[model samples]
Target chain A: MNNDILVTQEIGSFRKPQYLSSVFRKTSGPELSRLKEKATLETLELFNRAGLDNIGVAGEMYRWEMYEHVAASLEGIEFFGPVRSFDNRYYRKGSVVSEIKRKNSFHDDELTFIMNNAARKIKLPITGPYTMADWSFNEHYKDKRELALAFADILNEEIRHLYGIWSKSKSEVFEVQIDEPAATTHPSEMDLVVESVNRSIEGIHGCEFSIHVCYSTDYRMLFEKGSELKLHGYNLEFANRDTNELGTGSEHRKAFAELKDYWDIDNTKFIGIGVTDVHVDYIEPIQLIEDRIRYAIDAIQDPAMIRVNPDCGLRTRSRDVGYAKLKNMVDAVKQIRKEY
Target chain B: MVKIRSIEYGLYPRSEHVRLSISKWERNALDHKSLGKLMDAEKKEILKLFNKSGINFYTDPLINWQDILRMVASLSLDTPFEKISRYRETNTFYRQPLVESYPRLGEIREEESTPDSHLPGSMYVSDNSDHYMYFLPGIESFVSMSFLSPELNRERVMDSFLEIYLDLIKKHGMKRILLFEPYPDSHFYEGNWDIFGSAQVFYVRYGLTEGSFSERKDSGPFSLIASNEKEFDVAARHSEVPGIALMNSQNTYLENPEKLRKSATKMSSSLKLDEIFVTHTEYFDFLPHVIANKKVEILGKVGD
Candidate 1:
């Protein structure tokens, strides 16, 4: 696959540490590093089974969403937020440097210290710029779309900087993925979303681009408009039964495929089907994964056109369940590929 | 603990006179199904229906009609609402429209937030029970209120509608008048209209200390806010009974109707508003329930 397609573990382990604000505990660094290393090991093993040569493992966290409040409460300070919300679920603070520095510091000192030795691609997960902007109170712009585009402009610069780091690290592959749970809520924003994405990804060539849309119900609402947005592929829920949480079932899969078909899946785009169920404790057998994969491929009417992943970020489930689910999914997909 | 043992009895009518008035005439504008067996097939039974109604303060004469159009239809740019074109159908409603959606705007959404959003002029309940009107079985926190602008009447046709209404009330004993929510496009909604009104439109604003609300303080977002903002952060609080009134005129609200009766020895209070009205209607079957609520009192005969 050359360096064009960086394989997982073929690179190095991913880093994720519980970040603390400015205060350092005596054993904090070591404790963080140990956890990160364990997570990296689990990730590599799962990706290896899933047949991902250069896979990266990461987590989703709620601590960030309630950041200002969390920060205030933890520090015993009353806080509305660092960023006030126009609606909610977003903040309007922190510069790119500060954000990256904070993230990298936690990943490196606390998480990376142990995680670094493990071999895998260390990917940085960011809440997509549009979602970050959308979930926050907007101003200095007339239209919401304009605000989103402006946010995207700043984000594009941020991604370029991260990619520069990947280049200097001497790593064969470095990746960045945008978590876009809010994309589906304001489907009316879709008219200009594709153009905004192009602006964000402009000039950042050679790095794989991934956009994940979550809180799956948004899928049902803005599906027709969202399918047309420009992105390497989309990651969505396909099997959650909980009504509160987004669920993607056979019907939803078919609906997505239908919209994608309307968008004309002409080799230029790829669709990622989440194969692992993020909810519930029971493990799905490899055969069921195989069946779901078959269903997705059939529904899309194209095998090469699909990419497989978990229903959502693994941060939600316990570390063991997350690890097992990922391993099971990858294994099943590998078997399905062999049969094909 | 303060032993606040206060005597409680039903409040008597402030007026000593037994007020008796009936709607003069009733007519509907909308197309309605037949009231075939409901009206007189043999010998002018409607007159008999009226004769039989022993209308009193609590007894209302059933003047089935479309009141707003009779009053303000000419003001509307759209087609003026015509009569129901049918049915003197007997309808009885237990729920008051005024207090429908209590503690939350104190009114229902006019069957579905469209048809009734304004207040008409003075309208009183009829007490005769020979025939019944509709008894809406929902919440009744509102006393239907409406206001209309004069900008309408591209042809200035409203002048003629007022004539029809005044004549109807005088002749058919029209105790109530229906009014359209005066703000343009407030009365009708096909959905996606930028100009529809809020829950405030359904309520009548009554301030006792009022020079007028605009002339005083404490009137927040509910009073002078722009319609464009589509916001009313400040809820309206009026001590007057009907939290919000509805199109039906038979209802009124008194926060403590029971408390008004403490002077019963001097005033000889007893009759619930129901006690003052007609002899028929099933309201008596639920009499115990009403009395229990402290909403009504059975004062002995007025002058006995």
Candidate 2:
């Protein structure tokens, strides 16, 4: 392993194998567990082949959808019919009818399985409190901020439980990435996001915390108020809005210009820069991915402060395309590592 | 006694059948004409529900529209939208428009706007001589969803679109227009209310909190949409306007029809208003077709 290279990690989710996804909801008990394990094992092998420094829960196979997964395991939420997120993909949204309490440990099985089987380092991605509050219909709590704080308390407990399980075997810091796709949508609620996110990771030591916010129109607020968040890094999407041109110039890499804004606010936190777009099947050339990373490295001027990944989850793409995208991203990092 | 009226505006969700057809059409399994037929059927079914509910005005279900902003952007001649962004705070997404210059309006075909023409237009026609209501994104909302160039004049761009929309309303015989403005606190439309002159315009503001109610003055006749009773109370206390929309269209959980009717009656009686419109606070597009259908029935019952 090249220690000098920037850490390359899978952000949140990957396309599950047909054998697992086809029967994910239909079967339960040992049958579903067997299939999820099989799929996770396969995905771990694929990540290993892609030369990933960190595999995110081996493609998050143990859970179905992020919102539905957490909401289903909670006491107060009631599942309504499915609604479209984008394209044809739909997830069953829930309404918080009462005070939310954890009905079950959300990521225990996945994390336990990864610890036993995986060789590389692992990062567990949990849906953040702000996103949980934003996505659900709020029928409870005094307001969205209060509901978010309630969720933050629940998440703080869940993370502590997961950390207990991970600490038994591992001496190194356990990684936790809070997935908050709705983080920057409401610019006025940045304070709520900061407060709730800080509360989620409150007093949870020995765990490196990060936030994954994908496809936002404006990330300035997140960066501006980022110093207040108790997170170690931010994973954000850029390639979806960026040009594919292979250049490090200001005009060539228009989307990466936000790195300057981020650097202006705080330069200490790492950025898991998304180099490939997950919404399309077109495989970004290695040079294009290299230009994206090169632009970030030039702006930040630190290899350790930069991480490379896809714009968002690769669940939207087919397995082959996702694997190819990751492979190219890793290869780009490798080519750039030789310079250091 | 205060006169009670019911109406609905904003995009209604597509049924499973229509949603499936669209998915298939995207994959090349179904043809465009076939998909159009499916959507047309969906629109007709929604229209039937509206007529049976005895709504005083008819609005397009907009089942085929991707979102409010995207539909509005489609009317632009420059193809301003480039990237998909989240629609406000909702899980649904739309292409964010980037307006570099003053946007010129594309030609509006008579078939596209006239009540006697195609699917959405046809949706506006009723058996009786009922008024037609059209839903549009307000000026602030349009600016919020887009990236305006530094050189572009905001008021000029807003005025241009507003003028075209007014012309369309007059030409197509649309009696009412509801501008969907979710964020009133932004104050993006502070000095631009006069352009709506003489048009029966109602600004629809949803996702409001108690703090937001007192933040802005009532520029014109507008309606406040509340998702719950507490919000309804807040709106009641703040609104000196004639009408209010009080229901949550963003969720799938069915509201208690009896409770909703009672609440509407009590609010109307207490407020001593001349008119009350019982409808969803936001776009019904956030819901499933079956649930939205049920809510429409409840809306009719409340108004009755």
> Best by lDDT, which number?
2
DockQ, in order, for the candidates? 0.02, 0.29
- For candidate 1, write residues A1-340 as lDDT tens digits: 1222211221111222334211213334656445444555554555555456445433322123322211221111222112211101123232121111111211223223213443645555555656654444332356557756765765676677666656765455455566665665555666555557667778887677766765443354434554455556555655442222222465434434443442353335555666655545557767666666666655566666666666666543555676577667766666666655
- Show the lowest summed lDDT stretch of 10 residues, model 1 chain B: B15-24
- After superposing all C-alphas onto the true structure, candidate 2 shows an RMSD in angstroms of 5.5
Runs in model 2 deviating more than 4 A are: B71-81, B98-132, B138-140, B147-242, B251-273, B276-278, B288-291
Task: Tell me each candidate's TM-score.
Answer: 0.43, 0.82
Give one digit per residue, the lDDT tens place, for model 2 in A1-340. 4555589999989999989888988999999999999999999999999999899888989989888899999999986577877545678778888999999899899999999998888999999999999888877777899999999999999999999999999998999999999998888899999999999999999999999998887888899888899999999999998977778898999999999999998877899998999977889999999999999989888888998889988998889999999999999999998887
Overlapping backbone residue pairs in candidate 1 total 74
lDDT of predicted model 2: 0.77
Task: Encode model 2's per-residue lDDT on B82-172: one tens digit a residue.
Answer: 5676776677876667788677666533234211112222223323335356777766677767777779888777767777666656656
- Give the per-residue lDDT of model 1 (tens digit) for B155-226: 222233333334433544433222222122211212211111221111222221222222222321121111
lDDT of candidate 1 vs native? Answer: 0.35
Model 1, position A131, has a per-residue lDDT of 64
